[model samples]
Target chain A: MDIQKVTVAGGGVLGSQIALQSAYKGFDVTIWLRSEGSIERAKPKLERLRGIYKSTLEALKTDPSAWCRGLTDSADVPAEKIDELIARVDAAADSIKLTCSYDEAFGEADLVIEAIAEVLSEKEAFYAEACPHMAERAIVCTNSSTLLPSAIVGYTDRPGKFLALHFANNIWKNNTAEVMGQPATSASAYQAVVAFARAIGMIPLELKKEQPGYLLNSMLVPFLNAAEALLANDVADVETIDKAWMLGTGAPLGPFRILDIVGLSTAYNIVAASPDAANPDTTAGKIAAKLKSYIDAGKTGVNAGEGFYKYR
Target chain B: MDIQKVTVAGGGVLGSQIALQSAYKGFDVTIWLRSEGSIERAKPKLERLRGIYKSTLEALKTDPSAWCRGLTDSADVPAEKIDELIARVDAAADSIKLTCSYDEAFGEADLVIEAIAEVLSEKEAFYAEACPHMAERAIVCTNSSTLLPSAIVGYTDRPGKFLALHFANNIWKNNTAEVMGQPATSASAYQAVVAFARAIGMIPLELKKEQPGYLLNSMLVPFLNAAEALLANDVADVETIDKAWMLGTGAPLGPFRILDIVGLSTAYNIVAASPDAANPDTTAGKIAAKLKSYIDAGKTGVNAGEGFYKYR
Candidate 1:
């Protein structure tokens, strides 16, 4: 119940957002990276996001430095920037530490969030490394959008302490999150996770039972399934489908615009995660099939300049 | 195509909104009612809505009297009000007429709009009765959210001129409309409908083909389907679900609130028209079953002062 040090395993977009938001809430965060390159690539994005977070804090008339817990770049960020990152982390948290070794990661963390590649094996291996070293009461949460909580916790020794915690992007602005608790998860652990989410200004919906993608994606996947088919069949043009629903439903963006934001490659994974029965006859398979082609062709949305639709 | 007179069949909430909006667009429209009581019941509501429309016009800095084409009350509204209604209608359109007979309803009309009951038989009957009286180049459009476009137009003499012209509610402020063309509908017919929609200050989405509920409802039904099921199973309180989605997705209201606004009776009709397999096994069946009980017990929402949730 004495939640203190927290670690985010992986430096992906979601991992970074979770880390940033958690740190903003005054939790000392160490972002563990699998490789030096990920740490380096994630640094600029993290700094840029922090800058945006600063402006957000200003708008809300809150002081960002007041909650500056700490950030540990671990294996990825440039060694030269480590001191500055650690200084910010220290300002946010009472203490901060960084190390390239997995042992150092488990040694100092009270809550470890695994947010690596969504591959089952990759995440399973990461969980195995932390199970023995993490404190008995330390909560371990995943930022997995498509994986079941049972599947991820199955590899851990203290399975009762592991759960899934999803955060909406640009964590500082969007305040929604989903927390999935497995059958073996302790009530205290779920409450701790919820407490941590609340401490960070997140409105978390706790699932009574864990399902793949939990609730948000569970409700949304079927919609995307039909939309992709609609696009493939040329039933309606992209802009029309996008603008129609955007205006009609008051969704911030049309489905395709959202698909672009989530990345075509990521969208393919979500679509593939959905059972075929959810969409049997439609050729929305083109969404995934074409995504792999587009990614292979080096065309990923705003990041790569092209996906389902072009972005500047 | 020479656009002249129009007949709007039905005198319900949606039908009235459509009639009011169409009248505001400078059309001499005769709204056909099902029974004498309906016309009587609609009189005060129509006057109140006209007052709302008048304020809406003032808010937009326009003349209300000059914009109204007509306010014809069917059998329920007395023939004594005919001259006053005709005068209001004539201020906006070239002329206006009121009648109680279905046999003479579509005579000399350039366009016939079916906004009657969602019941297939009821709509089919209207199509059969009205089609013969429509002018040669006249367009037939339905403000149907549930029924298939082809099925309704199938009973018409000129299916090639049939389309679904859907307008959002609160039409005085919201100007989005969906134009769905049936399989047999001619290109010119679709174009003419689109032209009419545009002339009325609506931003039209010309769907390539007719889909059930057209574009907006096709995307929306599933969301409501999921939300309704969640409410039925007590997965979450109705208010929370409404708040979660409305605040989360930025919808004006959650599914339940929308259902209330749309009327439980109408919501039940829409659900019945939807493919049942698309909804949650437990929750999807609840709305219709609940309504059947409610209607039989005379407890429909707003009209009955109670539904899934009560309204003041």
Candidate 2:
């Protein structure tokens, strides 16, 4: 009943991270790509992940500041054991396998983690096809940012095994996994997922009930929304707003800086999802427009390297 | 004319700090207390402040953590300089004259900072009595937390000289001065106050328009409200909420911890002020009731050393 073999469907940013991170934590991970196009996209992503792990290991030896980078340390990794970590990552790389075929990927999966594109239809379609191919005891967990676990649980074969296993973007460094069960999900299934999250070196936060944005985003979004309102309403410029926040509260990063990291496209989508609050004068609409302008210019985020403030 | 003689009305926590800080920066300070009873309260407060300044000076020479305890810097000061800082505090204590008489306190004041109780009627009565005692051309500023600068400007003989000059609780380390002028506030009055703030070693943020909570609180209050809502609605516990925030975003402190520092009575009064949203099911009502119950038990905040979390 232990989750030894983990299959992560979707080889995008979070999916590749989940797959590589699972493998890095000693689980045999298979990343299922939708097609040759996605596989092509995933190759560079997986390669970049390798680079990230290498730099993270190197950073641990010299710079204390290096630890909080996207995919690295929360707890102190003793300097003496740095080589062991590098070796672990190397071994974990060996455990990860990528495939375009669902049958090959999900055949022996102890857990099928869906981290596909966020559209509900895409999720439902993928789940319908992938569920039948999953191993008999395989638990299904979706990494949907906005959609509830119940929204896609009906698409899966085992209702009792379906749940949400959410991760913050920088999986290696910001290692938080929020686990919540759909109404039909069994208590054992929830606990198993929680244990799996812990197995993969994540601090699992169990949400007792279903919350739309979960604990983190529910708190985070309003802050960002307020910041955006300040910017769009011309209350303050971006830099001033950032300075005020940094000075007032000793936060390491400002809201816009975080928005740049979170990706403007993703931010826009989140804003766009809430259409009821879309008047130009309203905060949500203004945020959407601001993000859309950046997105239109191909300045999506750190990946594209130009969001609120330009990145080199 | 240079702001040489500064008078701070009221000998409360912030008022005493303002007077002490102004004196530390070499401005002759006069503190106006209400009565002999308050003079007793002010005695221990002033004595404690002197002790704080001395320890802060001594701590600068050794520990790096002493900087933010209502004083600035983590740099190593030579033992000679530490003694000089202590001497300066003693000299500053010499420069600070205390009186219950408004006439004696304001006779030759260049700048008068009102840091009295928050109640508007209390402010109006104080201003009505004290305005006639002020030296001609002495700029007046109210350190009202939530009240508009316009609310009490009418009571001042020189409405053009009156404005809002708000400071955060721990004035020395958190050296921010939010200067906002009411409609009748003169441009020269605003500039002079800005210069005066700089003289006292403060970074003065000039708000072009009056914002009720000004810049910091406007951004901060919503974040706190959201956190309180989460706590009240049974979404998450305090520690988990704080952990999620700290881990998700690299903020130095969380909302509940901040509430603890801000004190529960102040927070309760803030929530209670908006009486329209008092339904039990609403987030605002839940927060109000939660704060009320805690305050009822006299578990007010860090001053009592037991708020959201017990402190030693």
Candidate 3:
């Protein structure tokens, strides 16, 4: 049950990071895409990620505290040693194959991490196609941010082999992998994924029960929603709310600043999914309306240079 | 309306801090207590706070970043200068007088802060009796944690002058004051309170509209609730949940640690106030049940040296 050959089923943001991180950890990684267009987008993303890793490795070579705990005992490690590790990651990157054919992608995958669109039908189709070609021993895991594993577990041919292996945005630094299993999932399958998560440099938080949004988002979203409610209710303006949070909690960034980093549109999508989104009186509806105005104005988030506040 | 004389109508934990801070700011401060027993309890709390201020000043001298922002330019300023400031604080401490007589406490008072019990009846009774004795131009403010300004504004004779001016714990350092006015509160009243907050070294977050729980608690309570829910559902252990939060958000302390600092009983009282406290199905009820078990065991919080975690 040693998961070495990993197949990532999407090459978008979280998917790309997961793929790059897996390769960097010396796993024989393959990225599966629906079309050549996705592969085209993924190429530049991979290159950009490589550049980021190079700079991060360089920073780790100098200051260990630059990125929290920098690559472990980074201070004692020589520049040549860090460069060598960077070269190893590059070598691992070379071994990764981009495939459009499901059979080719799932050929030797010990683990297939489904990172496709969050849409139910889309995930079902991806799993249906993937299940037919996947190895008999290969465990499948969904990289869903919000959707439950039970929703997709039924679509997979082997329900006991399917589970959720969620990862945070920054795979390299904030290396948190939340492993959630459906009721039918085998303990062996869950353990293998947990082991794989650790192998790829992530602290695995194994949930005994299935939870929508898992641990991080379950706690974080409510906090963000509360901040948005204050704005929508007109209790205080954005600056006052942010300043109050910063001054009160001694936190450098407030919820609004975090929303800017998350991209308001993505945050809006999560809120919009709930049944309460339709009611304007509800906090979700108010948040959606505020986000819609920003999204409509082309102020989506930090990437767009503005959201709740200006980035630059 | 130049406010000079200040009468704090309570000798509780927050009231003691408020009176001490006001005196430190050179206000002619008076603490009106219900009984001599209450004054005795407040005396030790004030001494401990003075000790905290001195040690904090010393830390600022050695390490500027020890506690967010240091008091003045402590590095360049000699230890003698810090000693002089401490002596000045001690001198201000002399100005704070304890009184059992409301007439004596409120005499020549330009501002009267009602920091009495959270119970509506007690607050109303105190306000109903103190109104006739209050100065014609004096402002009345409540230091309520959860209750809205609109709820108690009607109890005062001058609704236009009544408001809520809330402060966070540890007034000397984490000096956040939330200024919330009722629907009937005058613009001048709100402005005067905001100015007063600044004069006492507090960063005032003036709310144009009344909000229950205000800014800090509005955001904090939901976070604590989420953590409690995770524990109640048995998704993960306490340490695991806390570790997940800290590692994911880079937050210094998790919700459980914060509960310990707030005192579990205080946190319990907040949850118990909700109608859901009777039901085990809801998060509020679940939190109350968990907290009650600890409370029944006489493990209140940090004050009792035990809560979610035992303190030395």
Candidate 4:
């Protein structure tokens, strides 16, 4: 179990954070972001994140550079640079080998974590590509919030070794994670994944049964929808609607406030498009549609300075 | 403006707190408990509340006994106490009169507040009984969570004086109130109510139009329903669910936790039976029915030591 080198797929907020944190943990990490153009666009962000990581590590009184030593920006390196990236991943291999790759980067990974797009089809395609190249026992995990674990690995040959490892935002700091078990996910795999999550400073909330959207989102959606309804009903206006939850419930921000931060459009889509919304009362369908109307009208909430309420 | 005496009705939690606070505010207060039986049952509670009120006044650097010198307990006085209650109330007339009555109590009241049961029919019946007896200039307000203002006072002769005056639970401390307006309610009445609520150390979040459940409950029901669903789905145990809101979302307690403290049976009934639950997506119907089963089985949450999860 001397896994060292690791590859991180995707360069979204979650993916990037995973890459930065993996580097911080003293792992030889490679981030396989989409394309050359994306690499160009993401370089500044990656650089800034690295700087932040450096400062964070320094503040914590730890060696900042140790984990990020062989950090390679493998977004769109030439076919030749792929070997260089692979060599860099393997060079520091006396330790654990961890890779963040979609099958293409699989040759060097003793452990692979797929932090790619959340779409089921895209995930399945990458899993298909990575399955043939993965080491026999290389542990695979998805940072999925909703997609069912069994469904994700249903097409994979080694479904027994795969599991859903859900992480909250700010992965480097947050402790809450859900270790979900699929029907095919073996007990050994569950224990190993749980141990790994714990080793990396996570408070793992294990799922006895795999359910889509897991725990948090399953609850969060209905609350968000109700906020939208408050707006639709012309009940208390936006400020009061937002303020009531804060003052009455002591919520950090009211539902509408959280909705704006999460992107009203995204929140609305999730609520309206959720497979669970078949029941009107359970889904907050009217509110979701109302939110969509607001989004469509270019009033996408705080991000655009207007939502349920105007923002400064 | 010389309010030397006051009558506080109901003598329940909200009613008792309001009465105690009114007494501490230097008004000679008479509390109108429902019946001789209720008075007997509430004797110890009133004594305890008096202690709490005294401490609260002392904390504010005020003399409780001096202000509460005229406090009267109308507990066992029977039907004969009504005249004494009215006389005491008239003696305390300082413009704002808080009560939980729907009967002849409003005849002498300058401002009659209905804080009785949350049921629409009960509240409406009380308002009907109060309006005809109310002074021509007297105002009527209901501390309702969901019922429409139009419906509450629609049958009353003086609907123009009726509106919704929502108060947070800790009435003596929380300065927030919501003034909801019915179509028949006059502008002057709305403004006066706002000013009155403000005079009593409340910040009014005024609503232009009245609707069932108003704004706050409209926004809150979804949150409660979401929590119930989470419990039903086994996302997290009750404690963890409670922690997510308190620690994660920074709410005082998660929805179910609040429901427990508030009485799971009470909350379940409100969500399930309220006219507001007529809207879709609440699942209040299902959850409420389930909670009722628990309650019937003597498994009522927190107070009963068992709910979605066990308490010590």
lDDT string for model 2 (A179-206, tens) is 9888898999899999998888788888
lDDT of candidate 2 over B130-190, digit per residue (tens): 9899888899999998899887887789988999999887788888888889888899989
lDDT (0 to 1) per candidate: 0.68, 0.84, 0.84, 0.63
Please identify model 2 stretches exceeding 4 Å from their true place: A68-81, A263-310, B69-74, B275-277, B296-298
User: Model 1 residue B117 lDDT?
Assistant: 80
**DockQ winner between candidates 2 and 4:** 2
DockQ of structure 4: 0.33
Model 3 DockQ class: medium
- In model 4, which runs have C-alpha deviations exceeding 4 angstroms? A1-5, A33-43, A56-104, A108-110, A173-175, A271-312, B1-9, B23-46, B57-104, B118-129, B243-248, B270-299, B304-312
DockQ of 3: 0.73
Specify the CAPRI tier of model 1: acceptable
Clashing pairs in 2: A71-A172, A71-A173, A72-A172, A72-A173
TM-score of each: 0.79, 0.92, 0.94, 0.76
- In Å, residue B46's CA in model 2 sits off its true spot by 1.2
**Candidate 4's error at A191, in angstroms?**
2.8
Candidate 2 chain B: worst-modelled 10 consecutive residues by lDDT: B68-77
Q: What is the DockQ of each candidate?
A: 0.32, 0.58, 0.73, 0.33
Candidates in descending TM-score order: 3, 2, 1, 4
Candidate 1 local lDDT, A5-69, one digit each (tens): 88888777887777777886678778787777877777776777667655433333233333322
